[model samples]
Each structure stands twice: as structure tokens, then as C-alpha cells.
Target: MSLKSIFAIPFAKLATKKVYKWANKPFQTQEKVFQKLIADAKQTAFGKDHDFENIKTYEDFKKRVKVSDYEGLKPYVDRIVLGEQDVLWPGKPLYFAKTSGTTSGAKYIPITKESMPTHIKAARNALLFYILEKKDASFVDGKMIFLQGNPVLEDKNGIQLGRLSGIVAHFVPNYLLKNRLPSWETNCIEDWDTKVNAIVDETIDENMTVISGIPSWVQMYFEKLIAKTGKPIAEIFPNFNFFVYGGVNFEPYKNKFESLIGKKIDYVELYPASEGFIAYQDSQTAPGMLLQLNSGIFYEFIPATEFYDENPTRISIKEVRLGVNYVIILNTNAGLWGYNIGDTVEFTSLQPYRIKVTGRIKHFISAFGEHVIGKEVEKALKDSIKDTAINISEFTVAPQVNPESGLPYHEWFIEFENEPENLDDFTQKVDDSMQAQNIYYQDLIAGKVLRTLVIRKVKKGGFHEYMKSIGKFGGQNKIPQLSDNRKIADVLQNFLIE
Candidate 1:
């Protein structure tokens, strides 16, 4: 065995044991963690303002701190960007993670020194779990190429501002550093096209075993690599075995990835957002990602249907029931208390707290009371096309509340690499599939409250063009699959060819 292989096996085994210990502790010591986190922040400006000292129990903490969104904490976050200390966290933020905003402009999320390890540790444990599950360390000896954002951070006000992936790249463990691909200089290039080309050149002939990135962007890189080398990815990197993906559902792109790589490889999915590393797929045999309970973040779940209610029920990890969609609220070491990160998830398992990301809080279609989620829409589309030859590139769904002439219906704009011969038949299949999965949708249809779904084929490259027009074409940018209204749909109309 190679020296690197020998070194990685023992390290992987040790990390697996440590992660298991830490993960299980939250179940038994959740209240202790709640007390400790509050106690640690009691002296901070936010803590003092919120009367944190008197809080003693989980109930007290919930009563004192209101569930909040970005707008609720904008003032504190704005002050931190100006290099203010102790406004939120104990000290000035080490950096800021810029993310897509909702009603407001770009959101600048603070990342503190104390909370940085939470992101790092969860990521490390995810890989370690994969290692333990496979009982293989040979891949660790080979290089891992993570498609990350530009490491060249921009100064905003006084704090450093950059993508979360870029910030995470800066803290990859020392031992793994030796096996990481793509030179640091290349990683700093802001232009994604140029950076990806540089990565292809640097790692094309290297002993690469693992590749990690958002699925779409990684697919773009794979296409470029194949174009440049004139060989399948399997031939270019024979050791490449693990495909680490997050940010979007991998099902839509799974077949394409396998076709490019020339084989089906072990896959790991991560449930990481700019807010925190929330969960990871721990077992190859299991279906859902195990929620990270002890990773410096306290989580609460409110049923998605009741999210906008004045006093929605907040569920603890132990209280979560399987098959219910919940909007996650986080209290993180980064000093975000009761913050709603806007993503929605459904618990798949209660024993180990496993979950599947269902949709974003804002990305749901409820016109005519159908209440279709992004997960449902995406799944329906995938299911409808499974037996057909259609290959989808990207898609979005919007509610057509007031059509020029017909009953209100769901409108889909899809960009296809290969389309079904009969568009009406394709739309029928998708509509039938959606009805099968969502009872509300089926009821609405049967009651004559809604008509069949409408399909509009977007021009080739329309989705990417729209993303570029908004200056967010690459690196963690994904089109919202479902919207409550036609705001995104209206914008997408500009990109659709007649």
C-alpha cells in the first residue's frame, strides 16, 4: 500500500468513532447544549438586549427570542460588516458569507471564528463517514478536486466578503491539503470559466479519486474536461470513485454524470447552506441524510404549512415526526438566534434524525390551494420523463393565476437537450404524476378549481443565460424550481425564444 493510503485509513477510522460519539450526545444532552450556547453569549450586545441572562430553560429561550428572518437581524449584521465587535457574536466576524436575499438585497451573513469549526467539522465527518462505510482508503491517497468559488475575498465595509464555499476552502485540514487538487493561484480566479479551465489543466493527468462541487457546475467542468482530453473521465482519472454533490437535487443530473464518468460511483450528498452545515448522508445503505445535532447549531422545525401562522408550533429533534414538511430554524454559534434560513426539509427517519431537503420556504406553489412544493414538482417531472427519451437541462414552475384565456394552472418552463416528440403527451404525464404524489393537487383538479399544467419549452441555454444576466451564473447559484407567484416566471419569459 502507498504511504498516503496507510496514513488515511487510521485517521478515517478515528474520525468515524469521534463523529459517532459527538452525534449521539445531542439526543441525551440537548438541553445542556441549549444552556451552554446561551450562557456563552450572555455578555454580547444582542444577548444583553434580549435579556439572555435570565433565560434558564428551552422554553424560556424560545419565549425570549422571537423566530426571525434576515430582516429581523439586518441591523446587527450591518453593524458587524463595519467591523463592530460583540454586536452579535462575542467578537467581530472573521468574514461574511454573501447569499441570495429574499425581499431585501444581498444578505451578508457573518461567520465567526468560534462557528467556523462547525462548518469544517461537519464536512470532515461527512467524508469520514463515507470512508468508514466503504472501508476503503485507497481513494484518500489520490487527490480530491473540489470546484470552489474564488478564494480572493472582497472587503465589504471593513469585513471580508466572499462565497461560503470559498471560505470553507481556506480551512481544509492540513493532512488533506497535500492531496487536494487545483493550485491555490487558480482557485483565486473570479471568472468561473477561466478557473474551471485551469482546474482541468492542473488535474487532468493527476491521480484524482474524488470530485466535489454543485452538480450542474461540476457537469460543466466534466464536459470541458472531456472536450479537452478527448477521453472519457474514467480513462483520464482511473482512480476517481467518489462523487460529492450538494446545493441541488442530484437525480436530474445523475444519469448525465454517470454517462460522462463512464460508471456508477459511490455518491455522498450534503445538506449545507450558507447558514450552516446541517446534515450529511452517513450510510451508503440508508436513504436520508443524518442531521448534525452537535455541530454548534441548535435546530427547530415548524411545519411548512403553518410557517406563516402567528404562533406556529416549533418542534425539537426528538419531537419530529416522519413525513411532515418543516421549515428549519437555527440558533448557531455565529450568533444567529432563532434564524429562519428559509429552506424546508422532511424527516425520513426519527431514530437517527435523518432528513431530506424538500424545498425552500419561498419556493412553493399554492395558487388554487394546491400547495405543491419544489420537491414534488421536480420529482413529478423526473418521474414523467423516466420512461421517455427526454433529457432535461433545467426547469422552473410557476402558477398561472390569471391566464389570458383558460382556467388557472401550473406553468412549466423547461430547457431540454432532448425533448419528447409530443409536448402535450409529456405535459399530461407530468400532470398525472404530480396528481399521484400530491393529494391536494389531485383534489383541486377533480373539483375543477384548476386546469391541467401548461408546458413551455425554453430556448436552448436559456437558464444559464438568465443566470448570467443576473450576474450569478456559476458557483452555488440554482434556479428556483417553484415559485408562489409569477415573478420568476415573468423574468424567465424574457429568456424564452418564440
Candidate 2:
């Protein structure tokens, strides 16, 4: 065994123990921990302004601090962006992670010193848990090639701003630094296509064992690697055994990614965002990611259906039930109190606190009261094309309300890496799978309230072209799987060849 592998074993064991303690804490002292978090921040300007001094209990904290989206909290955030201290959290943020907005310009999220460890430490524990579970440190013994955004941060006023991956890239440890592929200089390239080519050239001969990125961008990297080497990924990186991915569900791209790699490798799903590192898949045997309860962030769940309610019921960890779709509400150490991050999740397990990311709150098609989310669309597409030779590169679903003719329908725009032999049959299977999964959709069809889903097989690179047109071509910008309205659909039509 390598010297690195020997050290990794002991460290992995310690991380596992720490993660287990944190994962189980919510079952016992979640309320007390939450109260303490609120109490700790009570001296801040926001806490004072919101009357956090009176919040002695969890309910008081909830009642006092109104749940806010980015727009609602923008005024206070503006103060921080302009270099104000003690405005929201206890102190000024270390940096701001800028996330692309759906309808607006850009969202500047804070990454404070207090909250950085919550992200960085959880990321460390995730890998450690993976190492522990695999019973092998060779994965760590080799290099990792992460397809990330520019690590070179931009100065917005006096505060630093960049993509979350870029921010994290700046902090990759010294030991891993030797094993990490594609130097920071290469990662600093803003253009994804240009950066990916540079990454491929740099890491083509490296002893890579791990790959991490948003699935689509990683897929692009893999494709470029294969094109360059004229060999499957396994031939290039024999030690490559593990994959870590997040930002979007990997189910739709699984077959295509596996096909490119030419081997079945273990993968762990992460729930990291500009907001925080929420969770990670801890066990190879388990399906869902274990929610990090002891992370400096406190979490609450409101049922997705009642999310827009004037006083929606917010459930604590102990109060959350299995199988219910809940929109997440976070009260973090970073000063985001009762903030809605706009993602939805469903609990798969309560014992160790595991969850499956259902979808985004905004990225869903509910134009016809059939609230079909990204998760559903992805699952439906997977089921639809499972038996076929179809290899989907990317896809998105949008409602066709007030169509030129006939009943309104869901329109699927797909970019296939490998096209199905029978397109009609493939679309039929998709419609069948969606009907089976979503009752409202099934009912709408049965009642003739909507026509069958329309399938538009776009030319290869259609999704990419559309993203580029919208100035969202690179760096963790994924095609929305489902849009509530026809905004994306109408725009996408301009990119379609047929």
C-alpha cells in the first residue's frame, strides 16, 4: 500500500465516527441545537432588528423570522455586499458565491468564516465516509480530476465572488494538491469548452482515481478524453474507481456516462450548493444522502404543496414523515435565517436522516395543475428509454399552454447522444411512464384535459446551443428538467432544427 493509503485509513475511521454522531444528533437534541444557533446570532444587526432576543424556543424563532427567498432578503444582502458588518450574521462574510438567477440577473450568497467549515468539513467527511465504506484507500492514493468553474475569484466591491466549485477549489488541501489534476491556472479559464479541452490535455496521462463535477460537464470532459485518446475512460485511467456528482440528477445521463467510461464504477451523490453543503451519500448500500444534522446549519421542511401558504407548516427533522415532498427552509450560521433555498427533498430514512433531492421549487411544470417536477420528468424519461438503445445527452420538459391547435400538452425537447430506433415508440413509453408516476397527469389525460406529451427530438447539441444563447453555457448551469410555464419551451423552439 502507498504511504498515503496508510494515513487515510485512520483518518477515514475518525471522520466516519464524527459523521455518525452528527447524523444522529437531530433525533435527540435538534430543538436545543436550533435554539442555541438562534441565541448565538441574537447580537447581530439582523437578530436585533428581527427581535431574536425574544426567541427562547424553536417556535419563537420561526414566528419571529419570516421565511425569505433571495428577493425578500436582498435589502439586507445588499448591505453586506457593500461591506457592512454585523448586518445579517455575526460578522462580515469571507466571500460571496454568485449563483445565476432564473428570472433575475444574479444572486450573491454569503460564505462566512463560520459557514465555510460547515461546507469544507462536510465535504471532507463525505470522502472519508466513502473511503471507509469502500475499505480501500487506493482511491485517495491516486489523483482526482474535478471539472470545476474558475478558481480565480472576482472582487465585487471589496468582497470576493465566484462559483461555489471555484471557491472550494481554492481550498483543496496541500496533500491532495499533488494528486489533483488540471492546475489552478487551467481551471481559471471561464469558457467551459476551452477549459475542458485544457483539462483533458493536462490529465490525460495522470493517475486519476476520482472524477467530480456536475454530470453534464463531466460527461463533456469524458467525451473529450475519449476523443483525444481514442480509448474508453477505463483504458486511460485504470485506477479511476469512484465518481462524485451533484447539481443535477445523474439518472438520465447514467447509461450514456457509463457507456463512455466503458465500466461500472461506484458513485456518490452530493447535495452541495452556493448556499451550503447540505448532504452526501454516506453508504454504498443506501440509496439516499445522509443529511448533516450537526453542520452549523439548522434545517426545516415545509410541504411543497403548501409552500405558498400564508402560514405553511414547517416541520422539524423529528416531525418530518417519509414520502412527503418538502421544500427546504434553512437557518444557517451564515445569517440566512429561515431562508428558502428553492430545492425540494423527500426523506427516504429517518433513523440516520437520509434524503433524496426531489427537484427545484421553480423548475416544475404545473401549468395544468399536474405538478410534474424535475425528479418525475427524469424518472419518466429513464423508464421510457430503459429498454431502447436511446442514449440521452440532455432533455427538458415544458408545458405547451395555448398551443396553436389541440389540447395543451407537455413538450419534451431531447438531445440524444445515441438516438432510439423508433422515436414514436420511445415517446409513447415516456408518456406511459409519466402517466404511471404522476396521478394528476394521468387524470388529465384520462379526462381529455390535456393531449398526449409531444416529443421533439432536437439536433445533437441543441441544449448546449440554447444554454449558450441564454448566456448560461458553462459552470454548473444545467438545463432545467421542467419549467412551470412555456418561457423556456418557447425559447427552446428557436433552437430546434426539426
lDDT value, candidate 1, whole model: 0.85
TM-score of 2: 0.97
For TM-score, the strongest prediction is 2
In candidate 2, position 312 carries an lDDT of 88
User: For each candidate, what TM-score against the reference?
Assistant: 0.95, 0.97
Model 2: lDDT to the true structure:
0.85
lDDT of 1 by residue, 46-126 (tens): 999889999987788888899999999998887887767888878888889988886888999988887888888888778
Identify the candidate with maximal lDDT: 2
lDDT of 2 by residue, 1-498 (tens): 788888997899987887677567775556665877778788888889889888877777777888888888888899998888888887788899988765556999998898888788878788888888877888777888878788888997778898888899888888888888788789888888899889998899888999998888888889889988899999999998879998888888988988898999999899997888889989989889989777777899999999988888987887999999999998887878888999999999988889999999888888879999878888888897676667889888888889899999999988888887888888888899989999999999999999989888778777778888988888688887888877778888877766
Which pairs clash in the backbone of model 1? none
Q: What local lDDT does model 2 show for residue 36?
A: 70
